[model samples]
Target: MSSPAPPSGAAPTPSLLRPWPQFLDLSALSLPISLSEATYRLTQNLRYFLPNYVVITLLIFLVTLVSRPLSLILFLCIFAAWIYLVFLRDEPLTILDYDIDQKIILGLLAVMTLVALLWTKVWLKLLISLIIGAVIVLIHGILRAPEDSMEDSPYGSLLNVVDSPGGEHASV
Candidate 1:
């Protein structure tokens, strides 16, 4: 039976994800016909949906690390320490009234990384897990339908993440 159409004032369909609908548009997923087509789709989709891709990769990385509590904890600690100390900190780090140099912090990070590798099998697992994440992201980027203009892409109109040409995203 033919159903009646909705009123003109009706709202549009809700997104699969409220913040980003295009992130999981199963209807639009497809395989590229050729290498050049795949490359074009990948480049365009990566620029158009980079934030979604990053979130997916991070979720996969964290989920994989969950099976290894020690590795997860150690990795998080090292990452958090580096972020807070090097990027977010407004004041110099000090120990025993001695100002710590950035070089020293980097050295400590390298030593800690070596210890993490030597004392555990984290190196292999970490490499495999992250590579899996990146592969998944790359696959998504290549499979999603290509957008000729990133600014006119679905999410592009909803969010200003991708600025118009000659704007903040100058490269785009």
Candidate 2:
């Protein structure tokens, strides 16, 4: 036998397990053509966007905290390599050499941060990493004297030679 239909004019009941609608129907979401319209839409969505922005900011802060130790270790390793190259390796020095090394370290730290965010939840790990990074930078800055200074600089010998009259005459 066929079941009787609900009475006319009554709303249909949604599924008990899934009370919300299935579709967001955002296919009509399009970029606004005019500046005024864009501003209006942005203002209208501020309530929705604000909470999401706050959540994202909090997550980023937590991730930075968690991944700080790894960042510090990477920084220290890079800093050690720099010192070795500049002081002991007898390598020819150039401004770009240090710049390139620093960039590589930063890139590695970024990757480590991303990995930490994905794999870990411990805040202690991140805090340690951050502390390590800060220490490495501080130490490196203190040890790595400026190259341009004529006196008491890492490149002082080279500068002295260049500044001496005999050296300039010899070069001419």
Candidate 3:
């Protein structure tokens, strides 16, 4: 049999599972008048209040300082700077438009190239490793077939590095 309703002027018991009935209301939000406003507020806060570029640079610097040797700190710092510049800062003059995946691959290739150049005892091996890194980078670009593929020159940059007698200025 069904139970009787609550007595007059008496409040009904609240459910434990569905506590905080006001949580369902959309108008109860205090911050962010709208979606665009929220985004603008966050961006503005970061731009004015937070010094992200300096923080990343300082972290990298500290990591490099406390470490025993400067083997990978330089690479780490460059990678961190790349991340901050690519994702956070909106300065078009100092920004790079490369995709995140492409940037990661390029960063790895850069680290490998640097290591190969430094750790190698002979010049020929370093050259070979640099060429291999370049080939891998190019292959990634071809496989992905990105919108910026045309910007990357196949025979120009790759060939210049592969054919250069000495380890020239190869910015991968």
lDDT of each: 0.68, 0.44, 0.42
Residue-level lDDT of model 1, residues 1-172, one tens digit each, is 3447869998533211224665777877887666866777788776666656655655665577788888778777876776567655546688999889888988998898788767866666667767987898788878887645345444445335434444454454
- Candidate number with greatest lDDT: 1
Deviation (Å) of 55 in candidate 2: 0.6
Model 3: CA > 4 A from native: 1-69, 91-129, 143-172
Per-residue lDDT tens digits for candidate 2, residues 1-172, read 3446879986434211111121112442454435544444444333223333333333444455444676545544544553344334322434755533545544665676566555655455545645655454333323322222246444457657777856544444
lDDT of 3 by residue, 62-153 (tens): 45434334534554555575555554433342228543454565577577646644663334433454465445433322232222222443
Task: Give the winner by TM-score.
Answer: 1
Clashes of each: 0, 5, 0
User: Per-residue lDDT for 37 in model 3?
Assistant: 42
The CA-based lDDT of model 1 is what? 0.68
**TM-score: model 3 vs. ground truth:** 0.22
Instruction: Give the Å error, residue 81, model 1.
Output: 5.0
Tally clashing residue pairs in candidate 1: 0
